[model samples]
Target: MLHEIGHNLNLDHANSEKGKEYGDLSGAMGHLYASETHPMMCFNAANTFDDLEWYIDRQKIIYKSSYFWEGDLVGVAEYDLCRTGKYVAIKIPKGTYSSRGRYDYYISFNRKILFNSGTMEGGDQVLVHKRYTKSPSKSYLMKKLRSGESYSFQSMTVHVQSISTNTSPGIATVRVTKETPAPVKPVTKHPTSNPTPVPTPGLTPGSTPDPTLNRTLGPTLVPTLGLTLETMLEPTLRPTLGPMERLVEHPMKKPLECSPQQLLKPSVTLQGPLSGKIKHSKSSKAKRPLQHPAYPWNKHSKTSKTKSSLNHPVNFGLENPVWHPVKCNDMLERSCINNPLFFLKVKGRRRNCAWLGRKKWRANRYCKKSNKSRKMVCRECCNSCRICTECSKICSNIKY
Candidate 1:
């Protein structure tokens, strides 16, 4: 009766580390076999209780610890599971979230007291359980730790320092620490060619020249080979080139002589790979710049045509109960059930149309969207539809 009540309250079966359903002997949800005898049956796992978010917020039974991160050095905190109104359990959240989009672990101490009188295996140790956002009612056993024992997961490590049996209610002290990855060394590259010092006409030898006072008259052209053409043209003694080496020259051997204003103006001739001429107007009328075909802001670009999150239609709950049906035979894909998690929070907390028991009218609004969720729930709520003939036998028992 208690277990069935737990299910009605949205609590799913707790699984053991061995992957057995209802195998977590520490909780009331677990069944006792003919050979096993546990007189003291405790409440459900901490994660299962946490799944009832409203209960956790209202009861205020556990102490919610700050999030754990890499390189964090946490102090010891004591927890008493047998009593409430104080810190009965400690919930430790890591910096990471599980695939189900919830904190991965819940730490709680389990000790026999009151209705929890049975001496279960690993009862004295602190138990860790996993939480899933999709199934808040379900929790999986992860680890059982004793004094001086530790459990390492991801970047965080939890250590049990001591278990005190001397107190009326057994207390367990735990410490959390995070291991940060070692820093990587940056690679330093040596410059292929150093900038030539521009000599100031009036500066004395061995004295540093002011860079602002000795700026270059114009930009210097450096080739891909790292040789400055202007510096190479100087009247200095040159080294003899090897037989394997050949000197390359610019395609345009003659330099263009232009006024200072002409150098700042945009050139009409397209250079390099383009090799084209652009039409320029003598009038002061400015023309819009040409955009690349793949540019995101271009109206005709493919990227601009992609649907954005804002374009999705809003879902306002149904005013009346109505059904819209589709021919299952027309569907190219087989009628298959989606993942249990796929329907979770589809319309925000407790607003899921398929899961809504009495308020099914709300489902009418959810099915209006042209998405997978519409098909998954609309067939049942809006219209009575039969399974497709192709996969009828295999999918007969499965619900959308």
Candidate 2:
């Protein structure tokens, strides 16, 4: 019953004697007095009671320390949470509910009670039912005790068969409790990447249980690689070429769809069969900056053309390479260039420099090699998996 109640309170197992999440029971002191006897909160997994009536048709109230044998409990214990110095005691009165097993739990009296009741599928060896609900059982401790120390007490032991059994309506009796607080774990805060734990003294002023503090955590805080809807978030970002290598070095036979940066990052090693400046042939038609034929867009066509007038930048590349409207499918390609990460990169012609864009383009800037060279480049490309010419890889000529 106590365990179920703790579950409702979002508490995990109290038997874990050592952990960093919730305060550690092994290292912490108790809040309850030594005289207030109830079974300490550690023995819930066993069956040591004979009051089966409390689970079937009656309520049975048990006190602290009274249930356990002399050495069953250790020194002082406290509720890891609530910090109250109290030992929780519980009871499920006879006839209150029909259960296949005992319905009593051990806990701190002052701490909130999360009570629960249910029946288990009985078995000849033993019967166990997981808690489904919890409510306060009402008897918790209240007195002076430190968070980690224990009080002295005379040890008491009992034999199960020696005790009188309440064989009335048929339900097993199980009593479990703790004398010392058990350790707890940290919980993750929603929305934020950090986790929070109770504050402690002398924790270095700014030192906190929150992981998100100081070191900023993020998914770049804003969109970078893929298409992301505009958001209210205003976050600064950094650029790295790692994500690109992951794509280019793909072990599978499939081709890689790359961002301009990814393509450039790998070229840094230039260790592949193909190395040095990627040269383009002055042969086949250069991949029109805008591959679509309907709308021949170039650096000059950035401004929109309405019914009124046109504010054009003067498309100077091809006397007429043909213009085409941007397509929905090509958005990924556009995004690679327009990404915040792309803009943040230092623009220049340094080794492994990522191409942001071109201010001025020429008709023969990048063209496919002759079908013959292409055949050779293609053979090399298939084996080396690197670009030497337009036809070698990144074929803008392939209309999407």
Candidate 3:
């Protein structure tokens, strides 16, 4: 994964096919698996040293140069190269020119890259060169400086002591010295107060009072006192008319009369355009009672009676006075065989069959015999069975 990532970062395979044979794993490229030791390129799960040196050398030479500079008594005319984290070189000329005034020229360096260009050289000492020119444009001519190179112009000379291309492009120290001084200016003192005092109009020694001030400040004592005295001497006056009589009134007009002929004529009723017919009140119309559908249990009651009659002892020849066994085929018969107490007992009391007293002949014949046994088999043989009744009466004379 790391090898593929190195390839994405624009790193190519090494030239040699050997592994870590000679303490240098920088040439282990194009192989399937690299040695587990050092960092290298083009190997699976391997760490080689070649990638580290390649990045370090690339960052050393990769830098952007600026065209602007700053210094005291010097106007810097340079370009701003917008890049950081790399080494760079800046060239500043030392000369004097008079555009606004006479300004001495020199170079000032700092750690921060103002306008993106600052001191990017990574070394303990940086060498500078001096170039002399009669014109300001000629002073800007700067060439690339190599390691251990020296340049001289007029009385000033610059020497390249050493250049470093391997150090990180971080904070570095810079040296600045005064190459020229600025011209001096003359000084003058200003007066503290005015020489002559101007006089104010009303406040002056013999000036007359203004006419506008006299009109605003004059008093009206006589007219105010005369009006108050006149009101006190005046007599009270009484009203001659009442409130109702004093109101203005107009004469009343006679109302117009109507004839009987006009009253006998029919008045036409106004109808809306969308009205279909007039709606009558609910009290004015006859109402009928609402009917509901019959219940499901009522419709099944007749069918249930026929099924119950099939289980009666009369159909099984129990009416001959001798008890006979009825077949346990229907649901009531099966219920009687399975649960005898359901038909023979009512809650806790034993009673005769429910149909014993209802039918005239069966009620008179077995009304007394139905109390002998509270079993459903006795009721089935006696021909007095009643399945839908609440009574628990059974025929006691019959055997199970």
Root-mean-square deviation of every model: 34.1, 26.3, 38.1
Worst 10 residues of 1 by lDDT: 330-339
TM-score, structure 3 vs. true:
0.14
Candidate with maximal lDDT:
1
Model 1 RMSD to the real structure? 34.1
| Candidate 3 to native Cα RMSD, angstroms | 38.1
Cα lDDT of model 2 by residue, 1-400, tens digit? 4334344543333222232232212111112224434223422211111211112211224444244421111111122321222222233222223333333322111111121111111111111111223332222111112222232212211111111112211222223322333446888677675665866666466655776658656656554765455543556576542332333322234454654343332322323221222322223244222221122233444433332122222221222211222222211111122232321111232111022222221112323343322211121111112332333344434211
Candidate 1 residue lDDT tens string, 292-348? 111112243233334222222211112211111112211111111121221222223
Model 1 residue 80 CA deviation in Å:
9.8
Model 1 lDDT on a 0 to 1 scale: 0.43
Cα shift from native, residue 161, model 1 (Å): 0.6
The weakest ten consecutive residues by lDDT in model 2 span 116-125
Off by over 4 Å in 1: 32-38, 52-86, 93-103, 180-400
